[model samples]
Target: MRQSLLALLAKEPAHGYELKQALEAIFGSAYPSPNIGQIYVTLGRLEKDGHVRSVGVEQSNRPNKKVYYITAAGLETLQAWAEEPTEGPRVRDEFFMKLVLAPMTGLSDRMALINRQRRHYLSLMRELGELAERTDPGDRVALLLIEGAMLHLQADLDWLERCQEELP
Candidate 1:
């Protein structure tokens, strides 16, 4: 979230609300709308870390709003972050833990667990498919994010099948 805000500041100086709006515009419904207070807290941390700086812009009838700008260090940090590759999918997933431990814990309901998760994945895929269809065709980024999520969910469903075949 820090890097994301910094990248926005790199484009232009903006107040917290503007930054929040920019994020929403970028990610659309896919990005959970960040709380205004969370934005302020991140901005405060960025300023304290010297990655960003804020100036108070006063209004005649309202309280001053702090507008944030990316400092040189912030720009460098953002660049580094952009270049870094994201981590791949996690191997030790929570569901896998539960699947392995449930028998020992006397659940012994692997089929039930697998069926429940399969239903969940199918439901999410349907939702994501709907979201992709509703998304603007021009917004390639948003479409790709949705596509990626749908693909991940499909992978999870496939893994569940493999588990069903291998496990008693």
Candidate 2:
């Protein structure tokens, strides 16, 4: 979130509301809208860290707004984040833990758990598929994001099958 804000500010100095709108425009419905308070808190932290500086802008009828600008340190941090590879998916996820520890925990229905998780993934895939279809064809970024999510869902379903096969 911090890095995302920095990148946005790098493009142009903007107030928190403007940043939120920009974020919604870019990510669309793929991500939840960030809370206004969360944005301000992140901005405060960025200011404390010297990654951003804010100035008050007065308006005739409205309270003064603080516009934030990215500093050199923020740009460097954003660049580094953009260049870094994200960590791979976790192998020992919470569901996996539940699957492995079910017997000791008196939850012996492992197949049921796997099937439930599979159903959840399938439902999400269906929703994403519908979203992709409704999205404009020219919006290549959104299409790519939807496709990537679908692929991940497919992989998850395959893993669930593997888990079922290995379970007693």
Candidate 3:
């Protein structure tokens, strides 16, 4: 969460609401949605740690919002995080777990689930492609995110095809 918050601040100065929106847009329905509380907590931590600071306050009709901007130290932290070396490939695949466990179920049920997931992933990939194309050309970060999402979906599709061939 800290790394994610730092990266979001690096993109642009945003109020808590906008930051939450961006996170929801990126994560979709997979994870629990972030709330104002989560955003504020992250901001408070970042501010206390000197990675981010309150830039200004905006008075809205509803309430005043504190806007945050990333400091140079924050950017440096992000850079270091980005540069860190680690294990070759990290894999935490819920879908694969589902696939592995499907053999206990009826064949029709298993196939139906696979087909449904394939269609959903394909739809998501198409949406990601459209989003990448629609994003501002200068927004390379967003485009890269979309690209990664699309690639993952495509790989899933490939796996689904292979399963189709191997099964029945």
lDDT of 1 by residue, 5-25 (tens): 999999999999999999999
Tens digits of per-residue lDDT, candidate 3, 1-168, equal: 888889998999988889889998886643468877988998999999999988667577766668899999999999999899855444437766666677776453557768988888878877787777777776665667677777767777887878767765
Off-target runs (Cα >4 Å) in candidate 2 are none
In model 3, residue pairs whose N, Cα or C atoms come closer than 3 Å (at least 3 residues apart or on different chains), thus clashing, are none
**TM-score sort, best first:** 1, 2, 3
Candidate 3 segments exceeding 4 Å error: 4-36, 43-83, 86-92, 166-168
> Which 10 consecutive positions of candidate 2 have the poorest summed lDDT?
86-95
The digit string of per-residue lDDT tens for model 2 on 78-128 reads 989999998886663888889988877785689888889888988998899
- State the weakest 10-residue window (summed lDDT) of model 3: 86-95
Off by over 4 Å in 1: none
Q: Best to worst by lDDT, what's the order?
A: 2, 1, 3
As for candidate 2, its clashing pairs are none
Query: Whole-model lDDT, candidate 2?
Result: 0.90
Model 2 TM-score is 0.88
